[model samples]
Target: MTDLLWPGDARAGDLFTDASVVEAMVRVESAWLAAGGHPSELSTAFSVRDVAVAAEGGGNPVIPFLELLRSRNPEVAEHLHTGLTSQDVLDTALVLQLRDTAAFVARNLDRQVAALARLAERHRGTRMAARTLTQHAIPTTFGLKAANWLHGVLDARDALSAAADLPIQIGGAAGSLAAPTALAGSPAAALERVAATAGILGLPARPPWHTARAPFTRIGDAFVTCTDAWGKIANDVLLSSRPEVGELSEAPAEGRGGSSAMPNKHNPVLAVLIRRAALAAPPLGATMHAAAAGAIDERPDGSWHVEWATLRTLARRTAVAADQTAELLEGLRVDIERMAATLTAARPGIDAERRKMGDDGPYLGASDELIDAALARAQGKPC
Candidate 1:
């Protein structure tokens, strides 16, 4: 819940707040009523702390939450939460929040990709030493490096987008819409109403996901992939900006990347933060994956709770990492002189690789063409 490290997603945090969650549940209830299955109205003045205090004892907040709402307006109690279970409300609310969160993440990813494209086009022919297995092995261009970064980001973004189309949960108690079938005639009709509600909420409509946790699992995996892509960029920045090999540096900014004891220390703070997010994501993802197996009955013990926290944190960290990577690339400084100087030290290694291929010089095969192809593909144009 403490998003101090990954702070670009303030809205994402707000979406999961006690009041916002209560509101989302009400929204779900309202959508159900609007489908003509029931009639109800929810009060926005419901006390959030009351539900929070009740849920503190390790049960779903929806129970006490509905109690408070019905007490406030007893007339609408029958229609409100009439057929839905705790997980139904919680899962639907989660998907609603995730849909909005995905929009912000998508924007950041697009900007990051565009920034990398520009960097690649600007330095298409700026030669640099390409390292493999932590050793210089071949001659390449900064453009190629940027292009590779762009490709990784594009792939991760695509994966994340696909995962973001989350399926909504509407199966009533025990993973069957039986409780609600009295109102909608059959389970299929109730699912139709659920799909309609999801359409309004901007979510993918499917049968009950009570026991099926793949939606959250895929989301966690996609975010982990995004963090990995950004981490690759960060790792390269950290290595290239080292004092001994100062080929790349973060743009100098006042009061940024300052050291506590070292006077002349200007670190790659953005990259470091991104790397931290990348490092933090996989463990959270592991928790989600593990939680999936624990989703035993219609309502398991603690697996869903694990998913709520883990998925939100993963999305927040990934969003922050994407935002930081874009900002880093926007003002990223590339020292052509330093890059050229490193090439001299890397000549022997490069020559060894070149001799193995019987090549005489820098064989930057199709790097420029790659940059052009990436740009064209980004622009939705034929390459």
Candidate 2:
């Protein structure tokens, strides 16, 4: 089936292209060759299509990729993947791809946080009915609502950044440096090669983590958290944009958000898609968690194979969701008059509460202070 659901226009769209993945794999291979003090020059004259058919024979792409490399570079072919295995090359390449992806997602997240901060500051005093259990319970400002989103996005961004800063994977056949030591003349020299590979890829230098899957699990969780934060905003948007509520609406764009059957419908398309991503991400993350749980022995049997597509799907969906969230916040429309009208309509409940307890000032206790604290945190000041 065609991927009609996710639209790709920016940096996030191109990071995981087949060609980019192949390039990353080739780069990893070259880094390994150079780290081993071998002739690293090899042919980059093959495409993913060239290796796709032959990949099934070995259950991974690296085997066929090595064949193509050998065919193209007869002189350096013998030393192409000297002490490396398929998992090493593929995992390191995946890290390289995620390095780029994390940068892209972080930029979009910064935009989203900035947009939300502005909204929170601008709407600090716009009174709206605060609902509990789908019913109006008290008065609150839209600023406070936006501040809640801002807090979530800020935490999500930090979590993603820390999780994406993962170490490069460089284990030989089995999470042991035996082959690398044999090739490099000493165990210390073998570790140096791993460090060199880390330097080349701009990832952290750490011991082999072929079977230690916590890093991948943490990264998956971070992606899910991103969708979790954005999904909450989308949920609120879906509810607030209702015709009956009419307190918020997505800003109109040309040739966008029109219903197929209804001519007068302006659908909440961005929020809908973000919510779709939110729903889709947790299961993918769970797959990684399950794989991690089942990862046994020197390497996993079938569990290791499950991570490739699962991580790619989760990362792609998250990148798209981050962009959608930023766009949603950038063009979000808040109806101040409607918020005031809704608050006015909820006055009967407010009056009933006031009769029970003595009349208080608007029942918006500490909302302004909470908004101030959120803004302070956004500005790097102590809240």
Candidate 3:
């Protein structure tokens, strides 16, 4: 079966490669080639296409490529990557991918947030009994749940915005852009220009981070931020849809999930899928963190590489999860009758307790007050 996610899109594949990274490497190499002058010029002296092809196979091809560059044109090789190292290219590429992914996530989040806000307004006074640990807790307007979900999504959005400013690694051989510095005015200036290029491409600038993997770690955290909120909504849907609870359920639909023996089962398939993806996100975040920790100065000791697959998998999967969550929220089926029934069943106990205390029972005390305060604040009214 064809993969529901990713499929075979060029842009998706390019998230890991594409021309941006290649062009950056080429520009660095060309500068070195020009330093040699005319016949000794490095541009005509090396083949990036050849190097790229060799790098494609992975295991230690970079060393051989450098060897070839040095043998054929020693002067050009002298300036080739300059003080830069492979981690520079790889890390920068990862940041670029993250920046692009962040953009996509941001747009989708905006849409989902708007949709949820509308839902909240529509259900502002729709009363329901809130539950804690699967037991009746207190009365709450369904709008409050929507508002809580919105707050979480907004938090994730803020996290992504912050992560977008993380710096890209570009220090050469030993966490210093020394060689490029020697050829192109100053190493610091070269790094600045590299950072400018990265920023232009939507990545943040940072000091040389050859061994430091904090940037990637931050990006991983942002991804988790989004996934966690999405997971909460999914978990709520699953819990609310229980036959015993039945206050909410997936929109009635055909072909969601089925039982072969019992023809009456309509499963919350999307909710289940989203929950599964949410469960997968924390481990993926940990994998990225471990990879970042494993990076050595100017080189990765396979720790960074270890996270490559997991990061990519998580990125693609989370995108799918986000899309699914949005759809689920947009089309959710809330049963007013069921909500009333559940609340009615719990009202007697609540009323008895309230009578016993006279004024201090489980009356959702400040909840309604808080909601009224929020509404008043939104309307520019006095608190």
How close is every model to the real structure, measured as TM-score?
Answer: 0.92, 0.96, 0.77
* Candidate 3 lDDT, 114-176, residue by residue in tens: 767766677777778887777777677777787678767877888888887756566767876
TM-score, candidate number 2 = 0.96
lDDT of each residue in 48-71, candidate 2, tens digit only = 787877888988888998888888
Candidates in descending lDDT order: 2, 1, 3
Off by over 4 Å in 1: 1-15, 37-41, 381-383
Best by TM-score: 2
Q: List residue ranges in candidate 2 displaced over 4 A.
A: 7-11, 39-41
Name the TM-score of candidate 1: 0.92
Q: Model 2 Cα displacement at 97 (Å)? A: 1.0
Name the weakest run of 10 consecutive residues (lDDT summed) in model 1: 2-11
Instruction: Return model 3's CA RMSD, one decimal.
Output: 5.6
Candidate 3 TM-score over all chains jointly: 0.77
RMSD of each: 2.3, 1.7, 5.6
